[model samples]
Target: MIRGCGRLLTMRTAHRVETVRAAEAALMTRLPEGALMQRAAAGLAAACFSLLGKGRVYGARVVLLVGSGDNGGDALYAGARLARRGAGVTAVLLGDRAHEGGLAALRAAGGRVEADDPFAPLATADLVLDGITGIGGRGGLRPDAVPVARAARGSDAVVVAVDLPSGVDADTGEVTGEALRADVTVTFGTYKPGLLVDPARSYAGALRLVDIGLGDELPGVPDLEALQHQDVARLLPVPGAESDKYRRGVVGVVAGSARYPGAAVLAVEGALRGGAGAVRYVGGAADAVIAAHPETLVHPGPPDRAGRVQAWVVGPGLGDEPGVAEVLASDVPVLVDADGLRGLDPALVRARSAPTVLTPHAGEAAALLDATREEVEAGRLAAVRELAGRYGATVLLKGSTTLVCGAGAAGAVRVNPTGTGWLATAGSGDVLSGLAGSLLAAGLRPVDAASCAAYLHGLAARRASEGRGPVTAGEVAGTLGEAWRDVRAGE
Candidate 1:
């Protein structure tokens, strides 16, 4: 339950399991034998001490769920450090054989091993260390350890996981079976995909990185990255002194029908607040959009006739609109979202020379991929990558954890860490499409526009809600300027 201001705001880079192993091996060769494990143990112990509060380490009841290999060894060594500080530490071994050196160190530090009634100590425990599995463990917890994991969860102890929670896929972030949920996970070297991507990400409550000095050993391009406030600030467009409305950029909106005019209003709201100098509105909802935002330049014809825009945002609530094809034909960057995603031609998107962005929810993505919604949600990373490759466009897969993959699906996928549950309201995606389209018009690359838009959209939602209740799409749009200022302040 240790909270901090830096965790969510910092740029997080996650490497795959194979990459992590290679980095650890390279670093281990340079360091002395057992030195790496000692470093991990020291960091783990310090994190646990902080969680236990000042002057609370002594006489605290601590239980360690130890398993085989280095994961258990890290826990055992950390537990020994706590035991030496006068804490009542107990280890419940769940694997066939434990690390010998770690076991010896714990016994010497006056920490006792529990063979009988392991569940009894958990009832009164103040802290529980989950070392039953590491990043290598997959397909869920073993049958033998299921009961113990449940008991640990049922207890009032603040559970801390070593490396990562057991039974979760480290690379895919998929929890196939039963897994242990941790209040805090202390990882070494670098972040794993499981710590950032959902299903597995939800299980890892709060993440703390313990630097074991593996920076140079890792690869230059990470598997995944999360944008920080400073990163967003750097990407945001700043208007020059001589910049005019057209010089900044103009984003055209081809959205809404007679029935869903609010969608048009919301999209226009987002575009006006986005980095673009001006927002152009087309389609049947021009009256509604103009009534809400008088600053918009309205057009009564198709997007091509809407007079020169740098980018077009199409398909927010067009029930039976015939503008998707027209918008796709334009040379400017186009953002296809909501109704625009329905029956979108991959060939048309691929043939375009300019950049294209597809923003789809799980259902729309499932439709595009011809897969079930459950499949898309379960394997969001694979879904987004496959979609990007198929359409040759930058894809933004929106969910509890938003993911953005660059065109061709070749580089590191950017994961947005600022999203809150309150952003699930209707018309929010429309706002996001407008915002991202505005960035595209402002001359940002496809990936940069999409990721920066998501960062701002999610941040605005968080600000509007203030962690108290639900937030409307209009409120989120209204708060965009505040979020933009907040990001710039970090720089």
Candidate 2:
């Protein structure tokens, strides 16, 4: 784990081609075309051998699913290396043209090509290299190649993808059609967005980046970033000796109602656990909130009388309540979530002077954008950024991987790294709202607060699970302190 300043270091998708081309150019300048392929082959062979957990490659059966380009060539040469080590190697060509030089190398090393074999020694193979397509592939798996990929997937052998899992869009992180699910994906040069984001991210089971030395030419700025523990630790606010409760920053939460008081309790819990100096609750659920957390200052009134605070969290369990509009109209940085997302006027929000952060799940985001949930889900990044630009606010789209986008000229998007599928449980959004609001109150920018809070919240859920069973929203809030410690300690 690398520790650094509050800033996060991430590999963006836009710069990937530049990085690859620079490395390819450098290698071309110094080495012969065949020489670079040999080095890549050697690296692949070493990785596969290590993964086998056995010293001898003599009896191991290896299957290479070859494509048309350099990616397929790498696999072919690697197959040749395995063949020379006494491993039985078979190459299944999925393209019209196989790498001529690579095929010659494999034959010289005693590897066999079986292009039409639907079941080419895959079942008994120790490992399968999916060289079907690389970063440049589009649409879906070629119609003819789909069934063969299906056959390979049905096998018991561990699957490794070269560069990326075929059929996944490298730049946008979109999965077009039937994609190969790999046990591990060995990416070259730099990380692709598909390897980091969801949908496509789910296919790339585990990711390993092989340096190949392309760091120097990467762009200075990234379009998106994933925060590590050290990054969050530096961003977290620590109280000082001179800091009083007011000076430390006050978070005002306007949430819940007579019908749903639990949302208020959960939100307060999230705020208290988030390291805020003080929490101010103003809603119909004041009594319920006080019952859950005695430290919170509960005010059974409207948003106008909520008193002065650095930040506000509106919505959560706020069911048809009219106070949502008043809260949104406040001068402080505000976070809108759950029911508060309904009937929001984009123009009014855009006209506000203070920063606003909207945390919407798919359905709510759809309502805000006047689009269907399916559309929002399909184009999550575009939808969130569009919302941010429309409302002149920072938007945090929560799902498998939360996406944070800042509005205006200095806009930059960030993808959250800390999350587990378990955090999908109910009432979790309430907790997230409170946590983000607290960070906003603590004086961090909307982008920083939303991204950092989401990272910590997700980490807490994972920590609470401990590789066991289902975890509740309360359990997630309880684990926030430990999550904070873990991030600070670089765990």
The numbered model that scores best in TM-score is: 1
lDDT of 2 by residue, 319-399 (tens): 987677787788889998988888889887888889999999988889888999877876777778888888888999999
Clashes of 1: 0
Highest lDDT scorer: 1
**Which residues of candidate 2, in runs, are more than 4 Å off?**
1-5, 9-40, 408-412
Which residue pairs come into collision in candidate 2? Answer: none
What TM-score, computed on C-alpha atoms, does each candidate reach?
Answer: 0.97, 0.93
| After superposition, candidate 1 runs with Cα above 4 Å error | 1-10
Could you tell me how far off, in angstroms, the CA of residue 292 lies in candidate 2 after the best superposition? 0.8
For model 1, how does the per-residue alpha-carbon lDDT over 1-491 read when each residue is reduced to its tens digit? Answer: 11111322357899999999999999999999999999999999999999999999999999999999789999999999999999999999999999999999999999999999989999999999999988899899999999999999999999999999987899989889999999999999999998999889998989999999999999988999999987777778888778889988999999999999999999989899988989999888988998899999998877899899999999999878778899899999999999999999899999998999999999999999999999988888999999999999999999988999999898999999997899999999989999999999898889989999999999999899995789899999999999999998983
Root-mean-square deviation per candidate: 4.0, 2.9
